[model samples]
Target: MSELHNHADRVLSVVESSSAAALSRLAASWRRSLVRHGIDPATVQGPQRLTQRELNVLVESNDSFLRSATPRVDNLYALVGQSGCAVLLTDARGIVLQHRVNDGDAEVFSDWGLWSGGNWSEEAEGTNGIGTCLAERRRVTIHRDDHFIARNTGLSCMDAPIFGPNGQLLGALDVSSARSDQTEGFNQLISAMVEQTARQIETDFFRATFPKARIIVAGDDTREGSLLAVDQDDLVVGATRLARAALDLPTEGELRPIPAVDLLGRSEESPKGFEGAERAAVMRALSRADGNVSAAAKALGIGRATMYRRMKRLGISEKSH
Candidate 1:
């Protein structure tokens, strides 16, 4: 216990003196968390979970988000399961909407309050990953003692902010390890991977939300992710962070929901009109359903008969492979 206190005090001293450290950016955030928010680093409390009724209401309200992000979150957990980490998706305000931990690491993660319905907001947990990422509005890694709260000093967290299609802050994705002694190199790698995974989730959400738009995947064709949504009028309606940055788009406050001509400096390829858009939507639904017409119709919220008629008019093949 004495050794733990010494380590915490040393971290605080570095932050207070503004001295350079391996985690200088995270240390700076911790300093602000303590000074600006008046959080007592030594006296920080544990996460406060919502009541069962409150949790149900919150989940119901964010039903769309849960549906869109759950699959990706599960994939992320599978990738990092061997490393004994917990993957979490939180709402904009830092409520844990969903989370996953390997069965072997479940007990350890639960002890650290890494379950659904727990609040990790800055106000609730000080300079932790989910809350701090939301506060900084950027990707960040809070490793172990870099956390403002002494109680959380055992956790190492890498988090990325998720943005909505129209450039609004939606939520955050976090990969947190209960192991404090992981090499800095490993943590950096985790941060990079987590950032990529978050971007993929954002892209998926954008595509699902704007099904009728001409979704263009920017960047290399060999690699997936990074997409822009173009409307039937050839206007750039939405873009992921990867797409916006790769395309040199104007700042978030400026270019969103604007024309592709304004930013891409070119008109969209000949849009096929409403028929083309509808056909594309149906095709996308079919693809999502693995070419099952019944499932595709259900996904598109249309009757099977109506879907068949639309498919016939749009010239979509009836053969489901």
Candidate 2:
């Protein structure tokens, strides 16, 4: 504990003297955040959560994200529960939309202001994982003593941003532990796991939003990239952050109407040609229509006989309800 105090003192000195060059980039950034939020590192207090009514309004406004993130957050909690970690799903604004904490540790975490409907934005809480990740728009692990606030020195947190099908910031996935040892490097492992889970949530959101589009899982290692939503004409209609990054797709501006060949490294001449694309489109349409051949065919703007012929040629067996 004395060591944490010393580190905090050093950080305060750096912030006071504007000598952040001595600290690592991450630590220096935290000091900057402290300055930006007008938080005194030396005399920081615990965070204040929203009132019951305000929290309720915030939660209700984010109903869609809550529904999409609940299962993923629950599964993550189950995986990390043994480690005394709490998993949180927060909206883009850093309001905790969903959280999982073991019953035994509930009181301790609640005392730390780590609970559902709690606000952990960078402006509210000095430099923790969920808030900082949302502020920086990146994955980060703020380990013990790395937080700007001395009051939160006992906590360690890893967080990753989750993007929606439209490439908007949906929220963040966070894994936090009350006890973290910097030397143990447990937080590093936790960071990787949380990032993977965040990607999964993003991919699921993309698929849910574009069930009728050909969901292309493309990358050097396809599973690494978030799924991409391609239209019947081989246009990129939607992409996950991972997909955008992996395929070197546009990071900014609209992504739709972008050519699939440009992103997927394949064309009509390739063995996996337009034939595969058509097959994927047909299957997705059928799936979206719930195996109603007439509806699926109409959605594809084709007659029923043509649809069945294409499905047969593509070896796609359909129930044809």
Alpha-carbon RMSD of each model: 10.8, 8.3
Model 1, residue 309: distance off in Å is 32
Clashing pairs in 2: none
Please tell me which predicted candidate would have the highest TM-score against the true structure: 2
State model 1's lDDT.
Answer: 0.78
Our model 2 lands, by Cα RMSD against the true structure, at: 8.3
Q: How many residue pairs clash in each candidate?
A: 0, 0
Q: What tens-digit string does per-residue lDDT give for candidate 1 at 125-203?
A: 8888999999988998888876877888888999999987656788899999988567778989989988888878877
Q: Write down the worst ten-residue block by lDDT for model 2.
A: 262-271
The C-alpha TM-scores of every prediction are 0.75, 0.76
Backbone clashes in candidate 2 total: 0
What clash pairs does model 1 have? none
Q: Tens digits of per-residue lDDT for model 2 on 171-253?
A: 88999889654343778888998998888787777788778888867646467546777765555677777777777777644
